[model samples]
Target: MSGGVDSAVAAARAVEAGHEVVGVHLALSRAGGTLRTGSRGCCTIEDAMDARRVADRLGIPFYVWDFSERFRDDVIEDFVSEYRAGRTPNPCMRCNERIKFAALLERALELGFDAVCTGHYAILRDGENGLELHRSSEEAKDQSYVLGVLTADQLAHCLFPLGETPSKALVRAEAEARGLAVASKPDSYDICFIPDGDTRGWLAEKVGTAPGEIVDRSGAVVGSHDGAHAFTVGQRKGLRLGVPAPDGKPRFVLEVRPVSNTVVVGPREALAIAELAGARFTWAGTAPDAPHEEFACDVQVRAHADPVPAVAVVRDGELVIRPDEPLHGVAPGQTAVVYAGTRVLGQCTIDRTVSAVPAAV
Candidate 1:
């Protein structure tokens, strides 16, 4: 059950619902697996132990499968390359799709399980046709944005027992009621590979930083930045400019020029973007069949940001998100999850923003 309160509670809920359940935790990285030998969080070895303990408490079978090589190539490598290409990537989404559900689900099937269950704060409801993935009732902790990458088959064999329950606080309360040890464990956020949350420092070690010129849209040099990878689409602080702006306002990161290794600084308004395009189109349903249909929907390009109304259109082999309102700092390599109310429509990887698009959608 991953040794987390949410997953533990999920396993409990499965039993409460009269389903025979077993726990499985993936050792996604051989290296991270070694770390889990000691304690929880990320790839550490202790988390594996904690998972096994939860399984023992539930009187269910549990096992840790090695998925290191696959995780490195699929999640870690993709995370690095996205930044090298000057785009903000969501590694968690990559992990959920490539590692957790896809890899673990396949492994679970090999072990003779009917379906897989996890701590994800989302749901699946079986209709006359098939199962439909829906956002969790606990919207504050909703994580369907990352899980949107799952295909229809994956969703069918997945059970998200925490879907309709209050999260965090209520999950902890359940854990206490069950007398589980991980009830008070802090929630895990940030990229698991970069456990310390130092993306720039980690990138420097892996990608090698080269100091570059910081400039503005006019092609005039404004300042110097540590490296292009060290900046993102809308970062404002830590520019360390020597001169003040003409209007005496703070400067913000507008663009990252990977070709010249330059970071462009400008007013915050310069970050507004109204269009987004990307590849690797994946939809639980409602895509491919109706590829040309236009639907007004909420498009969320990140995990926690609020979705904005947008018209989705596919053209020239990529998904185009034409937002009805301006979206600030829309970056490539991030996922744009479209939603129709609580139901997820589909998802696409952001390639870049278009010019002269409507101010909103």
Candidate 2:
């Protein structure tokens, strides 16, 4: 339990189902004493206490596992490295992939646990092929995108008790009925490590600023930024470019070349991506047999973003996604989750993209 209402209620439901359940809260960082200024952080001391209280109420043993070092190496360092490589990464997905499912699940299994349960809002079903991951009944709260990196073996030993829970309010109501104190706890919305949500500031402290030139699509220097790492593809607001485009149209960040410390800005249309190629692909269940070279599926590039119809193919050791329609702002290092309707097929880390706009000679 993350010391939240949903997880508390999930524990309750799991216990009610007549299964022996123990609550395990992960201590992800050394900043345990840090106060949660807003409802956008997890693993704080307050959250741990809340989780302990819920475990007490549920009559289950609770333990706080310290995984700070592993988290820093896998998730935090990965975040920094991806940004330094001029790519935007979803650290939450990395946390789910590396820490929660891999590290915690392995530990739980060694302790004779049949499965690791969490409060994620995704459905697990036994399909003909094997176990399948599906979106939650609550569409708005669906988290299958983040969990898409799990392999078939991982999905087999996982349980999500809140997948069918109609809504967040219902989970809170269940928590209240069970006399849980965290029924009204605000949901965490920001990156857990960056509690204050000042990503740029936090990154700047870790990766020192390097002055860089901001050039337009035509290779003309339009402005300058403190660092290319501070910007991301599809970003528009913070460019602070002093010059306007010749066509008098607003420009967007088209690319971040960290090697040369250059930020490329251009017309918004330049951000449109017609296809994407991803490496490190993982299937949630069994990889389906492809009679042909390509198959049809829905691809979601970001959490909470709508999945777009696409054609998928594995060629040259990369999962290639060709969206039926153009997708904008697809950056390297972001996850591209594939799904067939509501069933999550798998996901891969985007390595590159094919822009819709032709390159200038």
Residue range with the least summed lDDT across 10 consecutive positions in model 2:
284-293
TM per candidate comes to 0.93, 0.98
| lDDT of candidate 2 over 1-361, digit per residue (tens) | 8899988988999999999999999998886477676797888888999999999999999999999999999999999999999999999999999999999999999999999999999999999988999999999999999999999999989999999987988998888899999999999988988989899999999999988899987789999999899999999898888898888988899999999999998888888999998878988998857713899999999898999999999888888899999999999999999999999988999999999988672
List the pairs of residues colliding in candidate 2: none
> What lDDT does each candidate get?
0.80, 0.91
Name the lDDT of candidate 2: 0.91
**Model 2 C-alpha RMSD to native:** 1.1
Segments in model 2 whose C-alpha atoms lie over 4 Å from true places? none
Report model 1's TM-score to 2 decimal places: 0.93
For model 1, how does the per-residue alpha-carbon lDDT over 178-296 read when each residue is reduced to its tens digit? 98888887776666766666778999998897888987766678788777998888888788887677778887887777888988777777678878888778887544346677667
Clash tally for model 2: 0
Instruction: Please report the candidate that would top lDDT against the real structure.
Output: 2
